[model samples]
Every structure is written in structure tokens, then in C-alpha cells.
Target: MGPKVIAFFLPRPPNYPMPFVDVGDDILLDILALCDVYTVIAVSAIDKRLHALTQTKQLWLSLIQDSTFRHVLELRPPNNLELQLHSTRELVDLIKRAVIGPPPWWPGGPSSSRTPSYTIAFNTGLEIIHDYRLLPGARYMALRGASAVGKDLVMYEVWTGRCVWGIAKRTLTRFAIDVVPGGTTARVLLALPTAYVGGGYHLYVEEVDFITGTSSEVFRLGFATRLKSLIAIVGEFLLYSLPSSDAEEKQVLVNWRKSTYVVLNYGTETNSSAILIPGYIVASHPDTSPPYQQLFTVTELDAFAPHWQPLTTISLSGQLFPSTIPITTQERLEYKGRPLGEFMRTHVRLSITPSAVYRGASTVMVYVNEFPKPRPTPTLTAQMGAFFRGRRQPEESARAALLTYWLKPPGQACGLRLVSAQLATPSFNTSPLTPPRAVLEHSGSSFTVSYYQ
Candidate 1:
């Protein structure tokens, strides 16, 4: 007898619309795989069957592999492919959160008034004379100050407020401090300014051993014979703003690890700041015939004008130190001259001027301080004497606001996104009101930590 063949087709009712639920899981997954993360999330919420199919590990892993995806999931990827499947839901949740802003309890939201996970009061005898720097994970804080005798550097656990290590008062004065981000090891860079004329600053790099409660100086270098202010440390480069001479402003980059330096002159004197973006230090040359020649980005800020200028890339293989490239146009924000106080009165605003800026892997965070204009209060005027009457006094409290932006391409304006705005009460004992310092965390969140009288 001849071999018999059987054919099976999915059942369909006449004059009835095709039921999406009847679709096969494999077919559904294939379709969902082509959708972007946001689309996938939206479709998954439509029905239980589609949601289950979208939750498969294969779908999320494929989405992550797509080069077009800009957002990232905060969770770690598993080593085992099967185990990775289990993280599909977590990856989806993180992606959703990133697309939407932070949760209410996160630092950027209004509900952040909830007490911090940890708090520490300054010791009875220790007074913080200088600002402090927090490590990447917020696990440790590095504080530098001048005591009764001399300057000291102290490292403390953020949660427990225990002193992990201390470099007591020494003859050397600490100019500035920076903490390098790492997991197991803690490294700090201390700048010691020179007091002698024509003498440059000293750079001290130290590694702290928490177990032994001791710190060892690993590297030291005399940065220059000429006095310069250490502005910032980005990656392995130390940025120094040169003293203005003959009304000309300039900057220099010292790669202390590699023992090389570069001088960049702005031609005209303008208040400026510079920051180096890690990993992007090297890039392909645009005009090279080989199409693979490398270059580096040098981002400089025109502080007076409040604009960012990304100068042309310098050849990494070039011999000229601090190679000067063609001057690029400026990327200016619209809220340049607008005062933040205008927005603080309502306790809410869409966009405001940024007083300080910090860059992350793919975003830029800006800080704003707004002191509210005072208004006459009926009760206070009647209670006080005639000397205090008839005068409108400014509010003693100010608002500390943080705004975030997605780092746009060169020559593009950064779109501002409001994050957190909080009211801060000034300390009566302090002569001048000091704005709270904002710190950005690796987990895409930020917080303002301040000390009052």
C-alpha cells in the first residue's frame, strides 16, 4: 500500500476575526523579538498569553544583544544560558524603570524625604573645613580638612560612621582630594599645593587597606614648577587650570600614571572647565583614508557663557603635546541667564539654569541652588518691633534642585529632565549659606548631602 500522509491546519471559524490567542508561542516570540524594548513591554501587558511569551529568556537576551538599544538593564547577566533565562523578568522590570523615571523612594523623586539608609554625625572634636567626596558605591566617604595643628585626611564607612583609616595632621597641606572608583580596592588622590613662588603642586596617590586600618602612598609626583589649580581628575588625567597671565587663559592635562602632559590654550581668556569622558578617550579619525585612525575627544566648558564646546579630536599618535585642533562651535542651553529663584517660588519648574555639572557613562547631571525671594509675613510683622516692620524679608530656606540630561551628540543641546528639588533650611550659625553638594551614583541615581550648623 502507498504511504499515507496527513495534513493538519489550524481551525478557523467562518466570518470570525482571527484570534490572537490562537497564535503559536514560537511564532509570537519571533514577532515580539523584532519589537523594541518599550514595544515589547507594552504588548506583553495586553494579555496573559502574550505576556508569558514575552517573558521568555530568549526574547530578553536577544533584545539586549541588539546594538540599537540605548537603555541598559541594571542587573547582571548570568554566565549560564539556562540561568540567564530566569532573569528575563528582572531585565524587563529594569528596562521599564529606566524608560519611566525612578521610583518614588529613589533620590530623584519627591518622596526622597524618607530618611537615608545611613546617617553619620560629625565627631565632637572634628569640624569639616572642606567638602567631602563620596566613593562610587556610596560605601565610603573621603574627608579632608585642617585641624588645630595641620591638615588631615580621613576615610569613613558611610553606613556605620566608623573611621576606616586616617592620615593625621602632617606638615603637608592637602589642596584637593579625589576618589577612584573600584570594588575591592580603595584609592585616593590627594593634591598638595606648593607655597613657594614658581613651585608646582605635589600629587600623592594612596591606597587604603581597610583590614589593617592603614593607608600607603603608592605614587607621588611634582606636577609642575609653576603654580596651578587642580580642577578635576577624569580617568587617568589630572586637569589643571593655569593662572591667567597677560589676560590669556589655558589648561593642561597631566597623565600622572603615564608621566605625560598636554597644554591647551584657549587663545582668549574665558572662564572654562574641562572633563574627560572615559572609554571615549580614543576614537576613529573621521577624515583618514584608512578609516581606522584613532583620535581623542577633549571637552571644554565656557563657564562665563554657560556653553559646552567639544574641541576637535587630537591624534593619539601625534607628537605634539596637547595638540590644538580646530575650534568647534558652542552647545548652549536656553536657560542660560535665567535665575533659578523664579522657579523656586512655585516649588516646581520644568527647566532651570545649572550651576554645576557632572557627567556619567551616558548622561549629564546638573545641580541648581535657588534662594527664594522673601515676602512679608503678616504674623511676623505684627509680632516683631517697629524696627523690623515694613520691610519684605527674603525666605531663609532655599531649594536644591537636580536635573539630568541624556548626553546628546556633539553640537546638540542637552534636553533637560527634572529629577529632584528639595527645600533646604540655612544654618543660623554659618555666616553664608552653603549649598548642598550633589553626588551621582553608579546605579543611575543621585543624592544631595549637606551639613548645617
Candidate 2:
């Protein structure tokens, strides 16, 4: 037979159809290395072996380099495959980098960087919104706010999940918090009798008195009233003292100030002044600074009763202290005296502007949002590909049937699908054999990914 005829009739490679000579294994591996994750993910989805192969550093690095899937690896974080990567030392080193910075949470602990805890705020106004069934007995709920909220009313709601309190105070109240009757000014407290669960949490409130115009007397409600929500201790309020319509001139205070607060300890007590709560610290009113500057308050309000893992929610609000003042720098220093840092352990000076919106009786608006920005993703470098291939020249035949079946014809480009194949059977290019395929079982240190025909 002539050379052309001899080549045409010679049994074509085992995995190839008659029209094409086999392509090279090097090209096959290169194609896979070049494939973006969308394609790899789909291809891997087609076969178990392919799926395992997708986890390889080279393949992974390939997918990451593809602009489309890079964020998935970085954003989703620490995949299970990473555990199997056998690069535990590298992982540990990355976690170690986190320990050096002040964490997103308070009073720093070791190694919290890798697995940061979230600090989501629980809001007031009617009603506990969720059941939060995922929480265990050990994790507790904390109600954080400035005083005069019918915290007691809120406590009632916290315990019963019932809407029993009334709304007498508007959105703004002053004095920092409510105190026990005549006990003290600004002394907000929740006297719950239940055995505490999961250690406990703190509660702040607004306090007002009937002394009148002495400090802040212009604002006075004729009737004594109180508002509440969270179905219980989780809502807001308005407390008013009533004046006899036909008889007497009632005495009252114009400006209200913070007196006391309620909080608890888990090994140690967390300082619950305006500072510790991230939003409050940044948004405090100017005149309301100093008292907060000092040892804010010494109260441990643990409400966990033993064995009581009750399905609960609480509502809260402040007394809408009659005074109004703009948030100011001098006021910040008044409460945070000296440098803000030195007194942090002693005072709640860290304040941020509140981002939530509420219609209020006070002239000013409060905003409570301060969400953290999402972290940026890391990109895979081409050098990583070279490092990956170094491990495996790595293997046997590229003629496996499914790979052969799904293999394309050259127009396919960068996308979720495989780019086309050069009809030349993959194994043929590098092989000296009349047909193509590597006889060896393993490749190199990188391991093999053989799929059944």
C-alpha cells in the first residue's frame, strides 16, 4: 500500500474515530489547564474522576485565574478541599496573619481572625422579629440601647412575648436612661426574676422626672404614659407623668441625663456605656458625653434562669428626654475626657453615628447602620500553573471516551464549555506509536485522574 493508504487503513487509535489521528496528551492536559472553572465545574460534573481532578491545585488555580470563578474561592473561603490540599502549614500561617490586628469584635481574644464572629444589632419597636432557633443554650440575646425605654415594659415583653406596654414617648428621649423611681437619675434597669440562660446581656434606657424646667422643663407630657415592643423586653417606649387637669401645676426636669444601666458577665463584665456598642459610640449627642467618660456604670444584669431555654423576644424604646442637642466634638470630649483610647476599658466612648431611621419628637434624626465592606478576592497567578504542572507530566491516555465524546472541534472559546479539540487524537502528537496513548499508569507526584471509558 502507498504511504497515504497505509496511514489511512492502519487501525486508528483505540479511542479515535477513523477520520482523525489522535491528539497529544500534553495538549489534552494543557486544554484542561487552560479551561475556566465554569467549564471545569461542568466537565467535572460529568464524571466522578473528573470531579476529583478538578480539585487539583493546577486545575483549581486554572479556574481561579479565570475571571469568572475567582471570587468564589476567595469569598466562600476555606473549602474542604483545602483541608485535603495537605498545605496545613500554609493555612495556619494565613490564620496567624489575622491575629496581629484588632478584631471586628471587642476586648480581643486570640485567633478570632480566621473565624470572626458577627455583631448584628437587635432593634427596638414592637416585636421580636425572629425565633432564631439555631442558637444554643450557651449563646444569649442582648438588648442594647440608651435609657428611658420602658426597659421594664420591655422586660415584661421579653418574658411574655406579649404586647402589653403602651407608647407614651416619641422616638427621642433624653437623660441617657431611666432610673428606679427616685432611686437615681438616668438609671435604666430591667428587674427580671427569671434564672438566666447563657450567662446574660445588658440593657440601657432613658430616664425623665417631674421636677420641671429646672434643667430641662420645657417639654412635659400632661399624662404619665409608657410605650413598649419586641412583644416584650425587645421594643421601645414613652413614659409620661400625668398632671391633674383641674388642679395642680406639676414640677418637672427640662434636660434628662444618664444615671444607670443593666448588664451581665460571661467570665468578665463587658463595659456597656455608649462606647462598647459600636453604633452608639459613634453617634452620641455632644452634651451627653462626660458621665459616660467616667466609669460609665457598674451593673451586671444577668437574666438567665437555669434550664430556661424559652422561645423569647423583647421590645424597647427611650423616654424621649425633653432636651435636644446636636452631636458635637466638645460634647464627645466631655464624656470621653483625656484621650478616647485610655478610658475605653473604663468608659463607653467609642461612638459611631446610628444608621437606622425613626420618626422622632426630637429635632434630630438618628442613623444606625455601619456595615463592614466585603473583603476583596485574591487572584491566581500564571506562575501557579507552572508550579502545578511541575508535579505531573504527568499521565496516561487522554483518549478516555467521555473526554473523547465531549471533546470539541476548535471554534469553542473561553466560556463554560470546553474550547474545541484539534481532531488529531490527543495522545498521538507526543507518541511515537502508530496510534497514541501513554503506557504508564501514574504520572508524577501530582497523581493520576483516570476516567473509565
Candidate 3:
């Protein structure tokens, strides 16, 4: 007791928080993986060691597998090889760009606050890009182009711009692609054109697995004078066009999986164009009188043949253009001495984001160009014909409107947006009649309108 009393009283040192930098690297990585990209970036600034630790490849790779964020980005699984080629910082930056909009400092950022948009270009390994298409949900893109070696049909991950699957051939080919429901893979129908020994061209349709990269000949059509337009691959069916022996264009609906085909013949309608939607094939043709645009639908794939069912016919004369704009200009334009109204034409361009899950329903964008009635004079007729054929630019008087129909969406009404009447011709460099297109991006949440000249 005496010894204890003699000892001077000493105050215990106050407890303080441990420095974050003292945490083990493994624990730090685990913590960062649970955080959003911004949190990780903020933590990195606390200490030099943390700055390096936050850049760990393992940390960013784990973040990419986060399911909630993946859905938001509409991300397709990145190729394992391509995934490793990018640095941790670049991967983090990509997540940031996808989650939040592009950096405000970007030179050409989003065009509008409501609709964020930016452009990124990656090498496609083609000398000339013939055509490119984004599969439904915009997770993947298909491209066909000419290369110095020959031709290339390729598919890429839209976000990373990495070629996931591709083939180079010595012959020209056409491709139609569709996602396989799961995000990791796709089904591609390739049309190969070859010279038949007898006379006309032979078309061999091959089905390819995007994951395995193996292909098999699904079917072949002989005596095709021209390569059919491979419009789309909807489920197990393929919608395309073939020229019949009678010199008439036949729209074909083929169940490539079943090895059976049906002709989408709207009897005597030579001007019809068809596009495949989820549960329907939408066909549009002009009506005989007063020149109305008619839309027809063919039901989903069935065990037997499907026939076209009339949907509705709409007149653009009074709806799109006002009564003041004459159907036939005052220049006394006549077709065979008859008023040119009889020669009026409606050109339809159809686009669809085929998956219904992303948008609550499938959305079909029907873009119609209502051309002025043509005069029978060889000069005027040829000029008007050239525009429709995509050989010349659309005239100032041509009218266009975008009609969006949400198939089977509960309680939602369809809407139409009128595009500018002074349609600026998209420069294809090779073709003048290519229409302005609205591309659905990032799982139907946003879209960008693009024009090519």
C-alpha cells in the first residue's frame, strides 16, 4: 500500500483511430470491391500506397461482375483476352463512363441532357465498311465489310469494341445476327453467294455459333439471280427476300431450325418491304388509290405457314403534309395525261429492337417517306425513281415521319414524331438514298439518330 501511494499518478494515452493505410492489401481490395467506382477513386487519394492498390486488376475485374451495374450498362461478357488487355484504370474509367454520363470535360459529350450520347471508334479490320448493325439490346454489333484479303463478317462487343467472333472469306457474304437470350452468345445466319454451274447464283445459308465459332449449312436455294437481303434472324426464323422465276421478288420466312420455309407473299404487291419483330413480321405496301401506306402483320413462328394480316392503312397526304401542299405540284405534272396522284409512292424503312424484355415490349420504328406524285415524263419519272432506288437525294418536298408502335405493352399508347421535312441526304459516298436511322442503344433506355452520306 505504501509503494502504491508513492507512485505518481499517470494518465493513460488517449486512443486514436488507426490510419487507413495500415489496413492489409487483401482487406483493402475486398473493401474497394464492395464500393462504387467513385468511392474507390476517393479512397485512392488518401495515400500513395492506396492509390496504387486501388489500381489492382483483381479489384476492377470483380467490380465488372457486379450484377446490378452490369444490367445498367447492358453489358455483354467481355472476351477474356480483351479484358486483360485493358488496365485497371481504363476499366474503372469505362465503368464510370457507363454508370454516369460521359465526362463533362469531353469535347463532344451528350447532345442533350435527357439523352446522353458519345461516339467511340475502334478498328474493324475492314478496308471498306459495307454495313453494320446493332443486335437487340445493343450489347453486340455485327459488321460486314470488304478487306484487302477479301471480305469480313464480324461481331463485336459494343462497349469494348473488341471482336468477339469473326470470319474472313474470299467471297462476298451477307449476315443476320440475333442474341441467344443469354448475353454471352449469339446466333448468326450467313448467306454465301456462289456461281451455279447451270446459270444463276446459288445461295447457301450457314448458321454459326458465336461462342464456338462453328458453322453448319442450314439450307441452300438455287437459281438466285441476286443475293437475298438477310433482313433479320428472329428466334429460329429468318426473314429474307429471293427473286422468283417469274421475275417477282418473294419475301421468304424460313424456319432455319426446322429446315422449312414459307413465302410471305402478299399477292401482286411488288412494293412490299418486310421486317422481323419479336412475334410478328411487319410488311408495308402502298394502297392503290389516294396513295395510303398500309401496314400488315404476320404472326409469330408456328408449326405451319403464317399469312399476312392487315393491320391498318394510313394516309400521309392530309396527316403529314397540310392541305396547302399539293399532292401534285402546280406545274401540270401528269402521269399518262392523268393527274400524278395515281403514281404517288410511299417508301417504308422499318427498324426494331427485337427483344421485348428490355422495353416492356418490342418497339417497331416505321419510317415512311411520302414522295410527291410523279409526272409521266421520262426525265421527271427517272429522277423520282432514282431517289426511291437510293441512287439520288430526296427532294425538298419529300415528307417523312417516325411512327413507333409498342407491341403488347399494357396501357401504353403508340406515338409518332415528325422528322424535319427538309431531309438532309445521308452520304453513303456510294448511295444517296440511305435513310436517317435512330439506333437503340443500351437496352432500350436511350437511342441516337445517325445519318450517313
TM-score of each: 0.46, 0.18, 0.48
lDDT of each: 0.45, 0.25, 0.51
Q: What would the per-residue lDDT of candidate 2 be over residues 347-433, giving only the tens digit for each residue?
A: 122211111111110011111111123344434664477577784223322221110111112122220122122223333323221
For candidate 3, the TM-score is: 0.48
Off by over 4 Å in 2: 1-77, 101-293, 296-299, 303-348, 351-453
What tens-digit string does per-residue lDDT give for candidate 3 at 117-168? 3233543343556676666545566666634224387666555445566677
Clashes of each: 1, 105, 6
List of clashing residue pairs for candidate 1:
374-394
Once superposed on the true structure, which residue ranges of model 1 sit more than 4 Å away at CA?
A: 1-112, 115-117, 122-124, 146-151, 169-182, 195-198, 209-214, 280-323, 326-360, 365-453
Question: By summed lDDT, which 10 consecutive residues of candidate 1 come out lowest?
Answer: 348-357
Shift in Å, residue 247, candidate 2: 27
User: In model 3, what are the clashing residue pairs, if there are any?
Assistant: 426-452, 426-453, 427-452, 427-453, 428-453, 429-453
Best by TM-score: 3
